[model samples]
Target: MNGLEKKQDQRRRFLRTLYDATGGRRLTFILAPDIGTKLGLTQEEYTSTTDYLVGRGWMKWETLEGKASITPAGVDEAERLIAADAPQPERRNIPAPVIAEISRAFDATYTHAQIDNIFMEASAPGAPPEGSKLRKVAAWLHRINADSEVDALDIFGRLVREFLARPRWGTDLDPHAAEAYDEEDSRFLDALAAHGLSYHDGKIFGAGLLAPSKTLAELIRARDLTAIGKEFERAADKIASKSLGPLWKVVQRHLGIAPTPELDEDLKRVLGGLASIVAGVGAFRTHAGDAHGRGPGAPSIEPRHTRLAVHAAHTVVTFILETWKGSK
Candidate 1:
C-alpha cells in the first residue's frame, strides 16, 4: 500500500483499539505509550491524528492529560464500522480483564457469576450494546437493590469517587466511609472548646488552630487536592508546626502543654507516637502533597492517598485534643 493508505489504516486501527479497550465510555484517557502499543501505531500517528479526528468529529480531546475517547458521532461511526467489519458474537461471559479492572477500580471483590449477571442485564434489549463498565455495574446494582432506594449514579458515583479509572481531580467520599473522619473533627473541636481553645480564638502560647479548614474539606469534596494541597502549605503555618513538621514543640510551646507529662512510660510512648502521626501528616503535606501542578503527564491523586491525608490529619487533631484534656 502507498504511504497515505498505510497512514489511513493505522488511524483506523488505533481508533478501533481505543474503542474496544475503553468499552465505549465515549470518553477515556489512557497513557500515550499504551495507546501506541495497543494500536501498533507509531508515536506520531497516535498523537498527530487527534486533531484531525476531532475536526472530523470522530473524537474529542478533553484535556492535555492524554484523553482519547470517542465523540457521540465517533461512537456511532465506530459502532457501525465495527458491526460491518465483524460478526457480533454471543457474549456468554464477560472478559476477565474487564471484570478484573472493575474489581481493582472499586476495590470490591466480585465473582464471575456476579459479573456475568450484570453483563446480561446491561446487554438486554434497548440497552447500550457495549455500555461503559460503570454503567453496567451501576444498572445491575440499581436493579438488585431497588428496596434500598439508592440510584445508579450514587451507586456508580461512589465507585468513581473511590476509584474511577479516569484521569480527573474530584472526590465526594461516601457518607459511610467519612463518618469516622467527621466524628474526629467534631471531637477535636470539642476538646478545643473544653480547653478554652476556640477555633476562632483557639491559640495557645501563640500557636493557633487551623483556619479556613475548608481547604481539606474542599479537597475531600472536589478531589481537587492540588489546589487544596497548595493551601495546606499556608494552613501548615497556622498550626504551629511551621509547615507540617514535628508537632511536639508546637503542642508543647504553642498549645501550652508540658514537654512530657508524668504519665506511665507506656502511655507516654503511645502519646509520643500519636504526636509523630500528627507530624507525619504535616510532613506529607510539605513533601509529597498533591499541592502542585500535574501538567500533561501528571497523574490524578489516588483515593487511598487522599484517605491517608484526611485520616492522618483527623487522627492527629483528635489525639492532641484528648491529650490536652488529660493534661488539664
Candidate 2:
C-alpha cells in the first residue's frame, strides 16, 4: 500500500492496542519502545504516532514522562474500526422447513424475502454489514428466561405475546371485554367448575356450555382452554340474538340498568368493558380456543385466560337466570 494508507493502518492499530491494554480505562504509561515494537514499529514511529493520535483527541497524553492512555473516544473509534474490518459472518441459506416452523409459530405466512429480511436483521448483533433485530430479540428473550430452553421461533412467539399486552405494543390488541382469558389438565377445572361453566374430572373435558346446565357437573365439561372457549361463544351467540340484545342494547331492557338520568352515563364499565368484550371472547374462542380451523398461530393459553372466559359465562348466565326467575 501507499505510505499514507500504511500510516493510517498503523494509527488504527496503535489505537486498538492501546485500547486493549488499558481495558478502556485511562491507563497511564511511559511511551515505551516495546509497546511500539509490538505493532512492528520503531520507538520513533510509535512516539510520533502517539503524538499524532493525541492531537486527534483519540487519547490523552499526560505530562508525567509523556505518559499516554486511550480516551473513551479512542476506544469507540478503535471498536468501530475493528468492527468494520472484521470479516462478515457466513450467512446461513435457511432451509424451507425452518422457515415454515417460524412462519407457523408467528401465525402468518411468510415469503422468502420476508424471512431473508427478518433473518438478515435478526441474525447477527450488529456484527453484519447491516445491523440486527434478531440478536436484540434473543437478548430480550434470554433476559426473560431463567431456565427454559427454547427455539428462535419460540422466542418470537413470546415476544409477540409480550408486545400484545403492553399498551404501546398492544394498541392494535385493544383489550375488549371479550378474548380476555388459560390452560392445564387438572389445572383449571375447579376454577372452571366454580364459575359454573363445565368440567368433568377425566371424561368429556373441553366441551362448551351446549345446554344451560345449572352446575358445572351438569354442563358439558371442558378439559382445555379451547373447549371452555367454545362454551363462551355459544353463550354470546345466544345473548346477542336473544333478549340480552347483544352488547349495545342490554341492561336497560332486562337487567334494570340504563344510563344515569343526571349525567347520562351509559354504564360502560359493565356494558362497555364486560359486555362489549364478549364479542372478543367469541372471536378468541373461534380463533385460538379449542375450535376447528385454529390454524398454526393459536397461542397456548394460560389458566388465567380460562378463568376470564368462564367468569364471563358465569356473569351472563347468572344474569339470565336471575332475570328468568324474577319473571316467574
Candidate 3:
C-alpha cells in the first residue's frame, strides 16, 4: 500500500482498539505504547497517526505521556467504518495478564479458603465447581467475563477492598503489615497540629494544602496499587504547590531572606528543584498507577513500591512542615 493508505489503516486500527476496549460508551485511556505494540506500528508511524487523529479532533491525548482517549468524533468515525465492514467477533475473555496480576495480588494476602470465600461473595450465579482454588478461581473469572455483563476485573477489585476493610488475616499476609507505619503517620500529623495547622475535609487549613496522606495510608494497607499511585500523585501535587508557590514566602522568611517584593532567582531555583522532586511522585503515578488504564504489558506495581512512595511523601511533608513551623 502507499504511504497515505498505510497511515489510514493504522488510524482505523487505533480507533477500533479504543472502541472495542470501552464499547465506545465511555472514554477509556489507553497507553500509547500498548497501542503501538498491538498495531505493530513503528514509533514514527504511531506518532504521526496519533497526531493526525488528535489534530482532526478525533481523540484527546498527550503524545508525550502516551495516554489517550478517543473523542466523540473519533467514536462516530470508528462506528461508521465498523458498520461498513463485516461484523467482527465479540471479545469476551479478560486478558490473561490481567487475570494473573489479580491472582497474584489475591494469593499474596489470602489463603485458598479465603479465596473461596471472596469468590463466593463476589461471583454471580453459576460459580465454578470446587477444586484447585487457584485454577478454579482463574477459570471462574474467565467464565464470568465471557458470560456475565459485569467486567471480571472490576468485580475482583471491588472484592479486594471489601474483604480488606474487615479484620482478617491470611497465611501469607505480611506480619510486618501492621508495623509502626501508623505511628509515623500520627507523628507527622501531630507535628503539623503543633504548628497550628488543622486538617479538615481533606485539607490542612493553615497551610492551604490538600492532604490525602491518610487516604494513601488506607490504600497502602489494602495493597491497592491501582489507587495507591493515583493517591500519591494527588498528595504530591498539594505538597509541591506549597513548596513552590505562595508558601515559598514562608520558606523565604525561614531562610532568613530580607522582606522583598521580588523573588531571588537563586532561591527560586532551589525551591523549584524541591518542587520538582515532589512532582516526581505524581509522574510516577502516571506511569505506574492505575489512575489511567494500564496495558497488560505494564509491570505490576509491588508492595515495596507503595511503601517507598509513602515514605517519600512522609519525608517531603515532614520537611515542609518543619520549615513552615520554624519560620514562625
Candidate 4:
C-alpha cells in the first residue's frame, strides 16, 4: 500500500479502538497497554500509532506514573468514526411494551428520588411524568391492562443489547477478552458489571440489582461531603504540624481559585485558628472538670466554627463553578 493508504488504515484502526474505549463511562482515561492489547497491535505498533496521532495534534496524552491517557480529541475522533461507519438504528417505531419493560427495570433498580431526577431531565419541559418516554410505556401498560407480549420482550432484549454496546451509555466488559472482541460487546459487559448488573452470554439479565445510572451515581458520590470534610480536616491537621501555608496552597488548588497575598495571609490565620480549636477541644475533653458547667474554658465544639469551615468549602466550590462558567 502507498504511504497515504497506510496512514488512513492506521487512522481507521485507531478510531475503532477509541470507539471501543467509549463503551463504558462514555469519557474516561484509558491506559496505553489496554488500548494496544484491545486493538490487536503489538506494544511497539500501538506506541508508534498513538505517538503519530498525538504528534499530528489529533490526539493528546497525559502520563502519570507510567500510564498514558487519550485526550478529548481522540474520543471525538473515535465517536466520529462510529457515526460514519455504524449509525444507530431508529427506535421511534419500537413497541410500547419493550419500552415499558425497560422503564420498569430502571425503576426497580433506582431510588424514587433518582428516578424522578432522571425523568425530569429526560422529559420535555412541563410534561407530566406519564408523558415522558419511560413513563409513557408504564402508562401504556396501565391503559391497555396487559403485560408486555413476546414480541415486545424480543424487542426489549435487542434494544438492551444495543444500548449496552453503545458508548456514552454502556460499560466496558472483559478487558482481557479475545484480542479482537467487538468493542460494543466489551462495553456492554463492562457497563453491566460496573453498575452491579448481571450479564450472561452477552445479555443483560439482572438490571434490577444494579445501582442507578451514571448521572445519579455522580450526584450520590458528590453528596458524601461529610467524609470529604473529614479528609480535608485530616490533611489540614497534618499540614498544620508543618506549616499552614502548605494547607492553604492545597485549598487554593482544590477550589481552583488563585489566592492573592492578602488572601494567603487570611487563609493562614483561618488554618491556625482551626488548628488551635482542634487542639483546644482535645485538651478540654481530656482534662474536663466533673460538672458539665465547670469546664476549664469555652466548649471547643463551636457550631459557628463548623459552619464557617463548611461555608468556606461551599464558597470555594461556588467560586470555581462561577469561574468555569464565565470562561465557557
lDDT to native, each model: 0.51, 0.51, 0.61, 0.50
TM-score of each: 0.28, 0.30, 0.27, 0.23
Task: Sort the predicted structures by TM-score, highest score first.
Answer: 2, 1, 3, 4
Q: How high a TM-score does candidate 3 get?
A: 0.27
- Name the lDDT value of residue 195 in candidate 3: 50
Q: What is the lDDT of candidate 4?
A: 0.50
Estimate, for each residue in 246-312, the C-alpha lDDT of model 3 and write its tens digit.
4444444444443344768777676556655556677677777767867777666544565566667
Runs in model 4 with CA error above 4 Å? 1-3, 22-27, 64-66, 87-328
Q: Which stretches of candidate 2 lie over 4 Å from their true place?
A: 27-32, 91-328
Top candidate, metric TM-score: 2
Instruction: Give the count of colliding residue pairs in each prediction.
Output: 5, 19, 0, 6
How far off is residue 27 in model 4, in Å? 6.9
Error of 4 at 32 (Å): 1.0
Could you tell me the lDDT of residue 119 within candidate 4? 38
> For candidate 1, lDDT tens digit of each residue in 93-211?
22233334444433243344544544344332223223455455544443533423333222333332333222232225566545644554455444434433322211121012332
- Looking at candidate 2, the ten consecutive residues that score lowest on lDDT are 177-186
Better of 3 and 4 by TM-score: 3
Model 1: CA > 4 A from native: 1-241, 246-248, 254-263, 286-289, 294-309, 323-328
Give the poorly placed runs of model 3, Cα more than 4 Å off.
Answer: 1-94, 104-113, 123-125, 163-328
How many steric clashes does model 4 contain?
Answer: 6
